[model samples]
Target: MDTPQNTALTRALTELPGPLPARGVIHIVIPHTDRFTVVGNHLAQHAGLSTVAVGLAVRIQSLPQGTEIGIKALAARFPEGEKLIAAALRELEAHGYLRRAVTNLPNGRIVTRTVFCNQPTALLRPRVVAQRPAPPQTSPPAQDPAPEPPAPEAAAAPQAPALPDVQQEQEPEAPAPLEQEPEAPAPAPQDHAPFVARVPPPTAPRQPPPPLPQPRELTAELDRAATALLSDLRRHARQLVLSENDIRQLAPAVAAWLERDTHPDTIRHTLTNDLPQPLRHPAKLLKHRLTVLLPPPLPGADDLAAPARPRIAVTPFQTCDGCERAFRAPTPGHCRDCRNAHAHGPAQAAA
Candidate 1:
């Protein structure tokens, strides 16, 4: 009968045709000791260990000492994947199937060594040994020194300057000219009459400004109308509430309808007609109806109710981050539904 090491080597040899390669061949033996048997049996006892962990442990135990195992390598070999393989490694270590030790070198470098055990055991802490001083070197034997070179001489200084001669040559003087009469001042511009011979006719009197719109008019009552619309919407679906900002947003849509010469009542009727049983956002629904469902004007009526032309430079309202459902808010934040959900979360939790 072959020993465990020989048995493993023979099994490995079976994979090759006839002869084993001289290099790159690793010999690993599955120990047949009682400790190894106990460890194999104990693997099944770890309820927390997943199938991936068990597979990793078995693979690690089958490898020769100092064999490299990397995440990408393991991922390529096993179907469990790198993430699961990494998680499994942690689980294996936590359950004592693996022990890792980090050693620090005298050069301030750190090296990590992991030991996989067929049987689980406590980890061995790293021990750092003090570095010893190197031996002193002997002095070299005395020898004759080389001769020194001579220094160069300094340059001589210059002599003092002599005194200058008096009376230098001068240029000839120019002759004076006779005086002449003084020049006269220029005359001022003559006074001129206005461009027009006669004054223009008196202008027509300015007309008084048109009277301000009354409460009945949609323009003046836009805010109140928006509020009223919200109240009516709540009656159909009770979850809707428009903030002041929300109400202000609806004014432009209502104003568009008014500009189309659409009666306030007709606009409201068209909006509330055929409403859904459950409405998530009343403001969004109102905006869509006002902008899209708005009726064309009657014969000989103005088309001012048409949507404002879209411009690339002019950005529309921001979409809600929570649902991306509505553009009623000015900034990218959670919508009312998300806000309500957050507000009622505590109450729901208590129940």
Candidate 2:
């Protein structure tokens, strides 16, 4: 059926040239209803519908009925944004191509509904009509049940048999047996007075519990390590400043390093190495270093008590070029294992 909208769109489309020469190698189909064509073509010459507005209008006109056609939805599908879409909608309304009615539903909620039309009209604004609820349906009166037929008469009853006559009995029922009167129960004995409990003598008062041992104070060794770490940090970064709170926070991380048997020199080197040119956050830097580079724990006393074994000195050992493992070597070269593997290639099979 050609609605007013379809009629307007068809008239508008028919005015355009039949078919253009192939403009591009890839052509996409423009899917739209008859009404869409009418509305879109009518807006083609519209001064208010700029390039952006026209695009927004086309997107809105092509959407399926009941699909959300809001500024955000339009902006997502088309490059034109909420502002352009809003302007185009207003223009369409002014030109009689679109109508938006503010309606109050039966629930008393007010909402604006937009209606798109291809044909321009001078009709008045749409109004909200309060829906009148339908009247309750009355069930048809139940039909009276049909009358039942009368029942047949019942059969006649039989006559009862008669008993034989007996001689006069002189023996009387033992003089009407006399009913005996029951005697009231004797009164219960009165309860005896409650016995009094004997009281005991008072006992000695409780003594205070022995005083708990005082917690051990911070060790001198831990204090020294924390002080040394702070001093080294300040010396390395002259611009860095340490507050009392910062020192208090850094104490724990330093104590953790000490407990792990980390040497003071090693701790200083780890914390001072690779520091940013301008140290902005000293506490944070120290915290990261202490946590990330924490040394392993010390060996137990039993390990130290055992006999010592011969080991290569640090000066004689160097890292292997290929494997990066530390070993005693006279000069720079690959480790023996890596050398042997490299020599035995796939071409040199076992003989």
Candidate 3:
């Protein structure tokens, strides 16, 4: 049933490097000489990790040191939503592939440091060593003795005293004069005041607050509202007039605030209230407010409660055809009063 072309194709496929397997994952891998990531089978095929977590782990490992991998940064970089990415991060943490430490900096700022472990088991095991016997102690090498000094000259030596005549009587030498001892001066008056040491109180270590909840993705309607709100900030506060580029740059941050059920009025009040005097760099100030004061997402309804109903859209305003009165209706038509008059007029004429 095989033709000449098919036979050649099959032969070519068999000749290729890393022969194809009968089932599951055929790899025709080329050895990478430069940029590539090395992942262990335990991680790549981990039963505990979801596909997103595994891929995220590998990508994180390949990145250079000091790169930002925060929830916000990762959410912006990848197509995955923040909630899913957050869940994936939790999974990686549970598996011992990632660890996050919160530390209070000396400058009173709290920072989070993330550490990734390539070999989790190796981190837990204690190291072993083979002790070798100490080398035998040895004395230092000795140096040659210096030559002896030349003998002292005879002139430097003093002659011995002549002996006194044995027969002559020796008078007792006058007693040497007794020396007087010097007297000690009286001690200076001492102050009786008690000394008190002033020691400063010990400063308490600052504890980092609980982590803020991750923000949700903004919907299309919410994005438009956020952009409009930012563009209109100038009307509320003269100092907050922002350029097109600045608005575009800051729109996402504003959208994050709106995504959390915060009202437009509240946001406007927050940004415009108590602005600094001589405010320079309006864009930067607004950006700081948007980030530092972001509110948490609204809580979901209880499981036992019924789902909230969808909101009905308001009808568009239209002028009635019969009567020139503006009214709320989906389509142009006669107003209620006009319709009633017309209907009754025809019936009353017949009566």
Candidate 4:
């Protein structure tokens, strides 16, 4: 079972110049740890170094020295078969793990090589947690949980002390009243008020409310970054941060804090939500498109250059309200069903 090539490959991985069990192998294995899930999920797709497959590749060597090992040889001895092994290694390298150091083997052919890696190639994950079965499902009943004890029947409200219905006191029908004709009286008050000219009270004008504080304007570049990050995060659980906004609402105070106070690399300004579905994690759609609103103020830009006019963008609002479906602004308001329902309140109201 130990051909010279096989033996050399095994020896390279096992004797990798490292100090951990299965020495050189941990570079491949450690990344698969829970510590790197976010970056791991991102990389496996974009670059391929998902830790599970990569870690197993390294661990198979069981060496304890330097992690300097020939990748071709490691690939050969991997437990998960060479095809997946090469795939993982290629993925790892593409995602910026061990660089490709070409080493000339004794046969004078250039062989691909791998260097030991102790640092992560992608975003930071202080610790990667291994997946474990959810702690024995103590979650309350999915349906029909234990019935709540019946609330004690409210003590019958004390019967209003029965005041005998007063009206039942049959006042013997009042004896019939006599009828009589009356004489007309003369008018006299008009002249008294005439001298006091009819006075009308003065009306006071109402004050307008103070306007809401204006938010900082966002920039186009900020919008691009926000959208890119949103798409990047979607691969992971939405709970991890799925949907993102266009990035325009951040107030100046908040934008300064996000750019200056937060860690340079950590998520700065973000909002998230939980959604219902097979995609169990909540999807967080961004509220304000941020990218356009966060950059340094542009020189000589003015939003108010013309005479005031009421120009309401009723399209997106109308779609969200009337169609019950999300649509970009400027959707002709002409979806077939929408046309059929045009008689609905908003369409008719806007028209």
Candidate 5:
């Protein structure tokens, strides 16, 4: 449960005066609207202010400690036109959503950071739900055993002649037979070495594993598409230096793109998995892409085995331990405050 002070604080944050724009209409974030339409200094202020408010409140509500609020994330969430946001920013500055501001340039747009002074109400705790045990069930009482089944009526017994008991007894008494000898046990087989086991001699010549099965090749359309992909790859490979995987994506796609008989998903898998080298070589750019992004080999294909890439430099950014804040790197490989905080982790800083 939140303390009374915290609850009061959560309630105090106000909603914007009027109803917000209707859901599903063109807002800046949706791709449909021309992103650059908002013009003039006044409209720009509205665009900036409205968009900033949306960015600031939501960002504070979702803020991660020690991380900066990036402009791209804010722009992505903006509902109003950006130029209108610029105009609204002045109003917000007069009101109080943003305080001391800083900004950066991205994709040619100047983006500002709105440093938060207080936590937003949206971050407040939600009501808790309690779990309860289920009720027990009862069954009906036991009953007496069922009655026994009826028996069949017996037939009259047949009469037999009395006779030969004396003769039968005399015949049995004539002799007692001797018992037969028991059979001998069979010999045990010798054991082989622990590691030795009979294995078949090599049957087929060594080769790469067969490619993963493709979509039904029985269809005429699949054959046509396969041919096209092979041709495209040949063109692509001869002209460009594909790494091999890219060629695979193109090959199956040709079949998929041309074959009305195949589903897009199946075509995609075929193109990506068992595409022929003839088509693959021409699309060297794709091979380069796949080589970089996917280092592992495709099923039943060559190991790809590209060489190790050059190392990249990562410059450290400044961090404020007191408030758990990190600003973008203004310089390379050093964060002054985090280093100076006197709370250095046991591990020594890199030389």
Candidate 6:
């Protein structure tokens, strides 16, 4: 029988004395009766995932179906910026905790479908069912036939005369065993060589794209213009900041564009407009754009001849001295009628 003092002493030893020590995390879990989400240890204690990714995954799981979990929405709700949120989402996707797929609807609308997996490992691994050995088949024991009823007692019959015992006279000797023939030795098995698979010859390596065309002659003015344009690209778009080496390497390509009558503004717009987010290789992108969007050289004047226009001469107006009459003449002089009258007057006077 246990005493009260012993029981009390045992309880005191097992129970904690005061507040818990500040060491690692200690849970005082209170079960939620309603509105509780179940999180697996795979996600909560994953070694590969960052804390942000783990928290983001949990938040996504707790939300109701069809809720917006886009980068912008998450960024608005949480303190993290869009870049960090996007990075966390990518991490989750890489580790199989989340999946996003684009689907096109019949009505021509595109939508993204998101799926969250609680146990990614379990989902990925294949399930196996163990097969048990079958029990040995047994047959039922056979029963003996029922004993026949005892037959009536039969009458005694006379015994026949006794014959001489074969054993007592002479036992016939057992026949001699037949002589056994010697067995022939078996032939040895032949060793089979392993099959050698013939490998096909390696295919030719893929060729890289051709280099961008450069200007025939890089003049000082053209070089300065191209360099200035490339250096100023960062003002329009921050992501397009190019280094000195990049500017130098790409100056010739830009000079080619300038030589072909392509404006600096047009080049800048082509490089900076509608850029993809998180541009990784700015130099390579600019190089490709410069090559593809290069303008054709201006046509020569001789090749594109303009049509000749006809010329019309305009006469000047003059006022006659004798009469105030306006007439078209080369110089300031009398009208045609006035001149004819003067000539006739002189002839009349002479006559």
lDDT of 2 by residue, 1-351 (tens): 555566755665556554533344333346776654345454666775566656556666677787766667766876766887888777766767677889989999998787876545323434344455555576998999998765453234554555467555688668877867755555544343334445766687887533312113447778677766776677765644678787777776787777666778788778777777546677777777777677767789897797978886664777888999887787878888888878886548754
The residue-by-residue lDDT of candidate 6 on 299-321, one tens digit each, is 99987998778888989999998
The candidate that wins on lDDT is 6
lDDT of 5 at 133: 39
lDDT of 1: 0.65
In candidate 6, which residue pairs clash?
Answer: none
TM-score of each: 0.23, 0.24, 0.35, 0.19, 0.17, 0.32
Model 6 collision count: 0
When 1 and 4 are scored with TM-score, the better candidate is 1
Model 6 stretches astray by more than 4 angstroms? 1-205, 306-351
Please identify which of the two predictions, 3 or 5, would achieve the higher lDDT against the true structure.
3
The total number of steric clashes, by the backbone 3 Å criterion, in model 2 comes to 1
lDDT of each: 0.65, 0.67, 0.81, 0.47, 0.46, 0.85
TM-score of model number 3: 0.35
Ten contiguous residues with the weakest lDDT in model 6 = 187-196
What stretches of model 3 exceed 4 Å from their correct place? 1-19, 129-351
TM-score for candidate 5, residues paired by index:
0.17
Positional deviation of residue 74's Cα in model 3 after best superposition, in angstroms: 1.3
On lDDT, who's better, 1 or 4?
A: 1
RMSD of candidates 1 onward, in order = 43.7, 35.1, 34.3, 47.5, 43.7, 23.9
